[model samples]
Target: MRPNPDAQSPGPCEAAPARKGGERPSRRLLLGLLGSTGMLAALPAAGQAPTSAPKASFGYADVVERARQLGERPFDADAARIPESLSQLSYDSYREIRLRRDKAFWRDGGSDFRLLPFHLGFLHDKPVQLHSVANGVALPIPFTTALFEYGKVPVPKGLSPSLGFAGFAVTTTLNHPTVQDEVISFLGASYFRLIGRGQRYGLSARSLALDIGGAYPEEFPFMRALWLEEPAPDATELVIYALLDSPSVAGAYRYVVRPGPTTHVDVTATIVPRKVIERIGIAPLTSMFQAGEGDLAQRSDFRPEIHDSDGLMMQAGSGEWIWRPLRNPRSLRIASFVDENPRGFGLMQRDRDFGNYQDLEAHYHARPGYWVEPQGEWGKGRIELIEIPTDNEAFDNIGACWTPEAPLPVGEASEFRYSLSALSTTGPLHPYAQTQHSFAGSDLEDGHAQGQGSKRFIVDFAGGDLAYHLGDPARVELAVSVTAGSVMTRILQPNPAAGGFRAIVDASLPDGQTGEMRIFLRARGRTLSETWTSSWTAPAAAAPPQPSE
Candidate 1:
């Protein structure tokens, strides 16, 4: 998900009103007041007497109450104000300001998990409050400049203790027992990235999506506060609570993170909309797709392929598996699959061979795919895919999410629960033969001119029950259909190298028009492969060159 420089920041935790003469309460006094309420731990002065108190209980219910109260008031867009020095830092300068690992939370607590706060700057100007929850007590983790090592960025002198933080990252002994590796990060709005063992970061999951790829400008809701529960010394999972806020809605989120070969995050969210939301996306995923096998003509770099994800995989309520190969279209493309209850969906990077990318620095082959499995009945909704044209991979141009058929009720709470998995390989997820690769080009070999809008597509399906039917190739039939075009020729043959079957189709589309083509394999009366779908946009004829006067 892209960052919004103007996104609203979360309001600060409740505190005493400003004193007389428009003077705010001192940090020590505020801490003292909070200490009395058992909401914060105050540090004793150099010579002052030690002050101790019982800690108050805190959990998901507390955050839900905060969100509900936040929704009742108008959103305060000016809650966070970044210093001019920090707000003006360039990307390179911002990178220089790194959190010191030595000062990380729970660094010496005998726990496997560590939390590192991100300094506020660059695209992440809004600061979010952080708290540490131990036993039943919640203590705010106050921000301090000593927690960061500012290399060259000219941080102004005497920054306030309440400056807060842009976000935070969670690290653990994911790869090696002694080596700490980052497993998850909450940064830039409601976006959070995850990676499993032997995998690199790619797509991101969002708490909610509003008016994305719609007529109205998209809204970015951000995490205003986060409370991390201290894990046991031998705990394998970490629990986190977050307060999300935007102009249209406020939400409370709980994430149970478990890191392993395939990392899993169990998410539960309760959202209260300030008004009726016409377009809301749940279990939203964002990624990048500059160019891939299906659209090789758009490639400019030396790499044969460039993309975080190559396709969108979905399991419909009817139990049918469908794979739609992603494309870097010349224009904006939006496709929606209407269903009552989607089993699951994800943006997958099916092509994992390094040779295809040839970019050692990027290591695109190692990017992990994220699958969202709904925990409860999502009811009637449509899985929407939005592809925005991009010339380079620096920008994320692909988005997918489930949009409910009915608008969210105004001033009422709606809850959604799902499990997100960071997958390196998804062969076991599909029961039928999967689409190995897809390629398309002009159908010049069949006596069709290159510019005549006739195209040839070669799709390979491998694995599953295809091997059992390889002995009798004739029994396997190819099923192909086009929504706005005509199929000229279709053929299915055994691909011994793939241990499955290959289907080739020659289709013609009207000039300057777009069409969708779907193909699958079947034997007898049973389907033997997942449906492979793609879209094609016939190029418009070039205009005749005007003669020079």
Candidate 2:
């Protein structure tokens, strides 16, 4: 489903500071700055032509050297310099500023990709330097208001022509040969969003995550600069290099973006820590989950399910596939799955039925899921999932990433490489059966006594060899295990409607305790489905009825 072009909501990251009169910028406003031919026809080209090239040749190694040098110096918290007028603009005023399509970089160069720069204002106070690299020569793209059409926004006086840009978006002939559709964007801090054919914006990917879900305050790293390599007229891929900076670390990144049915981004990241970093997240993915099948009773909304992602999928180094359903927890919750030489992990939106989410404007079903496949051996790390409490769907409260066991050494560069794919289906990747749906509630309706602190769960397993065993349902068995609870009962039954098998389990846990439950299907000692894992917290027994009242 394509998202409404004018919808207003917070992005996948933290909400930006409120604008004047307490209004905030919408996610659409932040990610949807596409250029229009009608608006550009009357505007003139802005900024000066390319300046003289730098003395040395430009390449990925150059960006690494720059990052290393940057780590040696004190971190600059004031690098982004914006005039008060631009910084103080309201959300409505900021949305009025649009880039001119006729003046877009590489528009007349016969290249398949056109780069549009974002104007700095509102929540995007940080300015990132952009450069066009061609023939080993990197030329800086200067900033100018002449490239923008300020609708009703008043032009600020004495604006600097060297103020630089907030970030940029790349457009190509993705859906049609004559029309350009925005395939990717890099804006805000180190956050970026991508879409494939017939997909809409949903989650976001970050360059690096520091001290996330730790005791201390989390540190956000920003992209200080980007070098876009000029693409060949017939090029099928676009290469980009980025410099990342934060108080704890400085890093360099290279992205090879290929747009197709499933857009894939090949990423190479190298970081040098200024100090010993205890917690660092690699290939971090951020998303939103307000409510889903498991928590339908908790939601009062009209839509059945409203979320960008429904579950977390992982392939551990030990060749075990796991699926953990996401939730909007009552409090902050962090779950870790340890592994070595991990294969892949991602946040997936498996429920594609539009009826599940009746909101046509949001198009939650069309949101793409991103899978991270590690390129080489990443020894001794764990995939961490952090779910925060949120009452509204506007805020992003889901985060997943890989955290290494050892702290990064000071002043030493650490390198990691991975491929991220924005896809919709997981059948091609998973060999075993997968979890189709899951629900948890009390077991009263099943005639089982409402035992104190007991909860019942129903999990459906589909696909894979489950179809072959449908004729003989007695051969399948349900395996259940728990970390801090006791399984009272377990039953496996054939689900002819779904061409799968359903497992029902009743478990008991101590009051106020949280436990992890793992379930799977097996036949003749052969595992048939991915492990379904979930965390359940038993509600504390109600205060003894307050007899005095």
Candidate 3:
């Protein structure tokens, strides 16, 4: 299934060169340069002048009703048909087809923020219903070429009006007084992503996930209609309403977005499946983890580490915490943590070392770390982690969600609600310390493979005042367990560089089989660290070298 476009920053790849009237190439041309961009399709537009949307009384119940109605039928989205002139241009040309800043909704004299629509073309051919709320009723926001400057778009001789906007973004002063940062964006499917101040965008959150990562493949749900609610004249918050549609499920999403250094949004959703679903992933966060602490020595990148998030940080019902280091393994892997009324979980970006990613433009280090905090009891379920092995970072191969122990049956309905906050470092409780690093190498001495079926593992812990107690390194104890492997030498040592300690262990498995292992560190006889667990899988045996016979 196609990724929810809202979460990913599709490179300004559609960036076209300067054209006549300062217009750039069209989305069609630029997308062709990158790849064939997919669109949901659109209907014919009515010939008319653009108009403002009327106000409508809307609330939570309206949201549920929207989902319920869509669930009763099949989801069919029509891609927008643009005038041929715009379609023929390159990415830059299409971008040059700008929406006149002067035409911004409520820009003249209404509020500090104004509504600016997106141009059609490229992956945005799908026409989405955009509405504005004012007074008492909600009215449709009509479309017309009058709202935009063709630039070099070469508007066709006769084109229809009501060719609605592609999608929209909210721009506000994030840093400088006059600088408007594109904070929250709703484009592409039932997906939308946001970024906080001082953070670059990475990863996305979806309206709903239907049978994700399944053998039967997955179904992507797209948002059909959006209601942009202009906040109270003095309000700093922004509100949006979205209707999500797909073959399996239909849903509604209400987002109240507040942007800051730790941009946060309160998401409330109601999904009604047209049919029963085998799996419904809720409060899900999608990210990429190429390689990190646990297996850094195993990665091929020049940097010491590369990932959007480091590990799964769990604050359990019993008040204990757990941290599972992320792994980019040989195949798709899913890890689950079952609990009753979970506190919260998210795909995090813990390692923020700019040196980790040397590239200047794609500041992977500045990517935001998102956290999901359940507003109420979620019952028994698993915090599932699905890792799809990749040799690159272009794809988001890491997925973490709450897979309910209970599945919503076909033709049946269920409701789940939670709040997710996109955080840089504010979400998680400042734990006394964290496992800073982990290393794995041959168990043999002199760096040669001497011990058959043997490997040595090193783990480091840093943060807080753990180093001040250096005189009591011997007093530190470690609880390491090998659930299904054989162990030999284990040592707890100190690393002066990171101001932390390390847990070194050696293990052997019969026939090079795979198993699960768990380890933890304790200081001054108190359980000092979260449990560090890993699942090891045997690599597929390589083909025996073919000999000329």
TM-scores vs. true structure, each candidate: 0.88, 0.92, 0.82
Number of the top-ranking candidate, with TM-score as the measure: 2
Off by over 4 Å in 1: 1-3, 6-55, 443-453, 539-549
lDDT of each: 0.79, 0.81, 0.64
Span of ten consecutive residues with least summed lDDT in model 2: 1-10
Q: Model 2: how far is 331 from its true place, Å?
A: 0.7
What's the candidate order when arranged by decreasing lDDT? 2, 1, 3
Residue 430 in candidate 1, Cα distance off native in Å: 1.8
Q: lDDT score of model 2?
A: 0.81
Encode model 3's per-residue lDDT on 338-370: one tens digit a residue.
Answer: 888888777677777788777475577887777
Lowest lDDT 10-mer window, candidate 3? 35-44
Q: Deviation in angstroms for 163 in model 2?
A: 1.1
Steric collisions counted per model: 0, 0, 30
